[model samples]
Target: MSDYDVIVLGGGPGGYIAAERLGHAGRKVLLVEADALGGTCLNVGCIPTKALLNAAKTYEHAKHGSNLGIHTSDISVDWTELQKWKAQTVTTLVKGVGFAEKKAGVTVVKGYGTFDGPGRVTVRFDADGASGSGPAQRAESYTGDHVILATGSVPVMPPIPGAKDNPHVVDSTGMLAVDAIPPRLAVIGGGVIGLEFASLFATLGSEVTVVEMLPEIVPFMDAELAPMLRKALGNVAFKLSCTVTAIDGGSVKYTTADGSAEAVEADVVLMAVGRRPAVQGWGAESSGLEVSGKGVAVDDRMRTNLPNVWAIGDVTGRSLLAHAAYRMGEVAAANILDPEAHRRGEVMRWGTIPWAVYSIPEAAGIGLTEAQARAKGGNVQTVTVPGAMSGRFVAENGVKAPGAAKLVYDGDTLQVLGLHVVGSYASEMVWGASVVLETELTITDLRQVVFPHPTVSELIREAAWAAKA
Candidate 1:
């Protein structure tokens, strides 16, 4: 009676990963996507933004290479050529996903999918919409033993006046596809999306201004490191504890914490506020899946209240991270293929996950911060070490780039509770710290572990040693 073993309603990381796993297991799978295969991450969010950031970093490095004993002349950026390269880079990755789905023997469907009761899904093909490389699928009804709702998210465009119908206003997607860099840019939020763009544009000679409603940018990160990162990004102007009132043409008006009204005039206004799960506009209301204030309610195994229905990624609003989605997909699929997964302890939880913010000097951390540790009323010893102590950081970033690493450990148990780092290559280094936190390793245990010299990762070991003091 079922059309397939599983029906995936998205093509994002969570959806595709589930489909791939399901397909490879010899279960019939149908992956329905309305747009590109790789979702926001590959087509718009992570891949393109990182490409731009890398390009900006390269330019910034060349501009300041005199201290490193290297010099170049006539440094510039051809925006059109850069965009072309970005497009090609995205295209290649998308094709790779297509090949992956094909190799997994999954049936690819291109259309808008919505819930059609408990175990059924109705996919509606856009009458005249452009389709991705996947075969165009007509309106079809699909019933499955299990359904994965991995619809991902959409930018939270808050109701600010003139935000819509304005040429200067842009979201994260539009920000990435800018035809030309504006001289002055106003970013509304100071979260990951806002700050990342702020870092990208400021490096490329844009006068960037970040207005954050929170007391500090990257509120989810270690509080101490947040201010340090702001200071490191000296070029970009930051107005913290500010709330935007509206978006006027080419300008953003905000209210400071002190009730002072201020407006920033810019060529472009970026609404980098946040993202909400893409759960609306679908037939979910008609379905029996329980929707909560958070998002679609799902258990650790990603099962919904409705039988045979599951949700993952941003749609569930569990973590709203791509990596989290991947894990959620894994848990959801394992349960789908083998319903006894929960009995076998096959479940996903947010355990010591690594978090990263790619500013000029990137910031990444895992586990409890010092403040978080102290809040728990435990005796904690925390050490903040300069990344420059690592020979690689000194040689690569030089003395001017302020980079620091912190290790938070329990004074009683000697267990490492957290690791936070802000500097060059922080993103690349946080996962190693996550392992220490996950394993709950102690200072003595870390000391026994040898680290290669001249690498910034050595700073972790250095901090471990210092935490002893």
Candidate 2:
């Protein structure tokens, strides 16, 4: 068996980044993947979906350009062309990541790896039987001093009747690969994935309806941001506090808030409930690791109970985000090299991590929400502003709907407790506040800094000033 100093299983953002970092640190590393190099984010989940969403947005703009005093006619979307473009974009980026792996001197092994013991892995290649290179026909094993598990998650398909058999039923991956837009689309669940698809299809000229079991969409985000997103996607229908009982043919049956059952007919039904970690076939039992509802249990340094074995990314299930997984990879790598180094150092804080929902007029925030701050028994202060005040908003001169910037402050320390933005490019602006929140910058420190006029970022400064410490 080939051996190395480090072995990273699953070449997602977490795995590849850890491999690259270890290789650059002058350690012999092997990066293994079951599928493409870039994993879900690039292959299906984030990157390709964003490209499609952008295309949908462009189509919307072209269709409504006349409203903005820019006259245009005969607006049409060639979905085949759009899909082609999106695939090309994804291919370029995935190839770039492979190139980077070579440049970093990390060996890229393409196969499914399962933990055989504390410091050993058995890799089996996936099946492609045309040229006698089928999965069962080709297999390999490698041992390492350290092993990092970064296998990501898969979509959760609830046990609703006819869900698996119906051709109209689809998951997030299926939704991403649709060749053409359906006339009527029924999206099940109102979490991030559901809303994002609703926004994309609504913009792409599909009659979209989102049925959510919860009382609100994106229940995890601050309540204030939810209303803004709802208002932005006015064309989409929302059925909150509703439960899907079953699906048959192209009809979805659900119970509304009033305890009455109803059915909606649609060309497509997207099951966007959530995703779970891929831990079934990885031989967790043999490795003596514990699995819980969340995922594999690990300490702060991402080390499993077993020695020289670590887990990160969706497999660890701390946070499902790609960036969070990347950070966990770093922690796991550090702990592997020198456990004492991590043990003697400060632990990374999960909160204050920036999160964004890439729907129309994206929603993003960092730090605490106003309600969260108040719930923690702080004398909370807040300030909000409409996006119209920003020069960039004026330049676009789009219909001024409702958008706001909120700043939550601690009355005693005069420090920023939270910052939330719900408007165009809110994700981009949150980075500025993230720095402030991460560093625990006081309001007085913000005051001394000069903000360039007429930029959307200035709104953050204005919101900070309005907090009045």
Candidate 3:
């Protein structure tokens, strides 16, 4: 017999949400987290980076708000104060997680937990820290009817020389905690993470150069719109279709698309190539759980090969977004509570997911990309409209940094296939965008949904209007 109904092995968006749902549903849950309560998303990844980005955005406004008829002088960034504010923000959220777990009656064990064997786990408690609700024990074993693995991913550094073991090199986590912005920052990948950092440091008076191996940055982004974003990130230099050959102290050498070589000087190099599921130190071999190419394998209900064993979030390597993990957890938790009474509608659906990159000109997308739609052997039609077409976008952002909204639809059926938006409020439009696509709503259906006036969200309707035209 299992000691508990559910035992969550990580406290990320997936793990915590699963634990919360299980705990509230009257299931005995023990949440084991080696680090802080919120895991990487709270402690290092999303929240902290957004904090720095907000500070950078504010600094940009003060320095460049002259065109907005605002005059400001001597605007500066106090790295120390900014770091403190970021830390406080993280602490507040961590404490909230603790409170939530307590309120929901979840016993949170502060320690590194690993699979001891089937239906079992061993946790090594921290002697100096007290995240555990129960009395501390250096080593203890717990058995559960089911286990949910939500161990998050870590930044990946490429195979280039000096990418590691170099004092000047930093990953996403290290970049967040940097003492000061480098005067010359060379970002070795131009995906979301790299561009976000490039945007942050570039706006903070740093000369930022982005080097990407792909022909274009933001690889999976809408093809036409990605270049516009590259243009919007005007201050940062981009070396697309280039491979980083080596990182020799304070400089990065690269080979161009034509095989020509070039180099750029840098004070710091950020390796934001991508992230891989953290499958290490989790006792995978001993547990006998199945692991796929990159992460733990899971099914539609977020179930693994082992009976009643589930995994979610980046650990699944399915959808890396925090929101994706939350939805995955919701589905898993429902299925875990009662296998026969699983929430049918809550099954994890990949296409319904929305994505956002928090850059100066934010990018958001939902459903299939235009290419994906065409690849499905369907008659696809797409409408591309400027952000300036929206009254609020024009009024608030002016025409200086205009972004676009594009809707990809089935020309034969008139069903919306995808919606992509970029600009000032694009980051805030994903949830509503997701709802429209998730419901498989068409132009006729969308036309009936009234959008509030003078809002950037109207760009959705505007793009839809153009799609059917």
TM-score of each: 0.96, 0.95, 0.97
Q: State which candidate has the highest TM-score.
A: 3
lDDT, each prediction: 0.87, 0.84, 0.87
Of 2 and 3, the candidate ranking higher by TM-score: 3
Greater-TM-score candidate between 1 and 2: 1
For candidate 3, lDDT tens digit of each residue in 19-105? 999999999999999889887889988899898889988998788789889999878888899899899999999999899989889
Residue-level lDDT tens digits of model 1 in 209-288: 99999999888778878889999999999999998888879988989999999999999999999998887866677786
Query: Once model 3 is optimally superposed onto the true structure by TM-score, how far is the C-alpha of residue 343 displaced, in angstroms?
Result: 5.8
> Candidate 3: which stretches are off by over 4 Å?
129-137, 341-343
- Clashes found in each candidate (C-alpha, N, C closer than 3 A): 0, 1, 0
**Model 3, CA-based lDDT:** 0.87
The digit string of per-residue lDDT tens for model 2 on 187-287 reads 99988889889999888889999999998888877787787888787989998899999999889999999999998899999999988998888788667
- Order the numbered candidates by TM-score, best leading: 3, 1, 2
